[model samples]
Target: MRLVIAKCSVDYVGRLKAHLPLAVRLLLVKADGSVLVHSDGGSYKPLNWMSPPATLRIVSPDDVELEDGVISQWIVKSTKADEQLIINIYEELHESSHDLGVDPGLIKDGVEADLQRLLAEQIELLGVGFTLIRREYFTAIGPVDILARDSAGATVAIELKRRGDIDGVEQLTRYLELLNRDPLLAPVRGIFAAQQIKPQAKTLANDRGIECKTLDYDAMRGVDDSASRLF
Candidate 1:
């Protein structure tokens, strides 16, 4: 991963458009062909990011851009969509690269881990014809808790939390945004599953068109228990 700290401005072009004024910020260019722009804060979420399968290219500033003091331009284009993130570098503060080998991936623990396993096995709990694709479905940002196909066969991305809150909803939103960019899952929907979902989180999830599901930990575990065996 290449990490660059620089004074830059950003513009996103595609279905939706946005702009970030020039400021000193962190730029992450990952080996996966993804680029993320982050400010000094805002927790772990990047201000703007381009998820892989994508490509990054650096070009000298044009005369007009150069006159404005832009030293270089980084263009990140998504291979699967019409989206691109353009970063105008005005000054380089620091830069470094790290070799992060194949990741072993995050390990879920406690009840949350059990929930994911149970849900995958009893996917019908989601709906009559729902079928689980897999647990911890890989994405550039992170692994989706579960990936499934709904009754009609549309792709579904799920984010599981022990206690569903606004943060979980936001996380799921990011996953859906990235997942839907892939042609194979262009219309992926989302579900926020947890043992207890807060009112605020439920409201936010509903506002974002993400369905919310309450998990029954004990019931699910009970279903997993072995039935009586004949002597």
Candidate 2:
């Protein structure tokens, strides 16, 4: 059976729509499976006139095999969170089909992007101004995630995390030490932003004057998981 994969529309907001919105063409696999179609103007608008239903030809013995292949041209806007969500979505799709190799780098990039976006939004909502410095630098411990400005005009060092981890304190401590040592970042505050926190680590942080918090995705906000503030 010949599978004619129909053209579909994907929007700038990362939403998949039936018809194209404006002049932008949707990203899709060509019917012949020879090439992938993508939008050049940041949006894809599907043709309004209804033509024959788009179909995908099945050349394999099993119809399920048709859906088994990875998307050849996974086109995504270059934003970090958007790319991460795409990788996650792709991972789920691959797992369901049990036939795709996920790129580790891609997954890491996705995760970092998600963390960065969440942290940025949290900082903004919390009334803390910040800047994401995309500079290349090395440290005795490692690379710092984000450097921002606090309410007092002091530099702030922030690290983003997706889940609960024990090393957040130690990790932030190392970065904080480095920041304190640096003539430029010496006065900056150190912070760790995660989806959750560890108990003992939080206590240690409070003793040391470090700040740790959690970002609640469902609530669309940040919660102070600081030990000093909690108990």
lDDT of each: 0.90, 0.46
Best by TM-score: 1
Please provide, for model 1 over 47-69, each residue's C-alpha lDDT reduced to its tens digit, 9 standing for 90 to 100: 99988889888888553445378
The parts of candidate 1 lying over 4 Å away from their true place are 61-67, 223-231
What is the C-alpha lDDT profile of model 2 across 1-231, one tens digit per residue? 111232333222222233232222322332222222334542322222111122223233232322333232223332212211111011211111122343242234565566666666556644545554442133433557777776667777776667646576667776675456445556767677676777776787787787877766545534444444645
TM-score, per-candidate, Cα-based: 0.89, 0.43
Q: Which residue segments of model 2 deviate by more than 4 Å?
A: 1-109, 129-140, 219-231
lDDT of 1: 0.90
lDDT at residue 202 of model 1 (Cα atoms)? 98
lDDT of 1 at 69: 82
Which 10-residue window of candidate 2 scores lowest in summed lDDT? 84-93
Candidate 1 local Cα displacement, residue 180, angstroms: 2.7
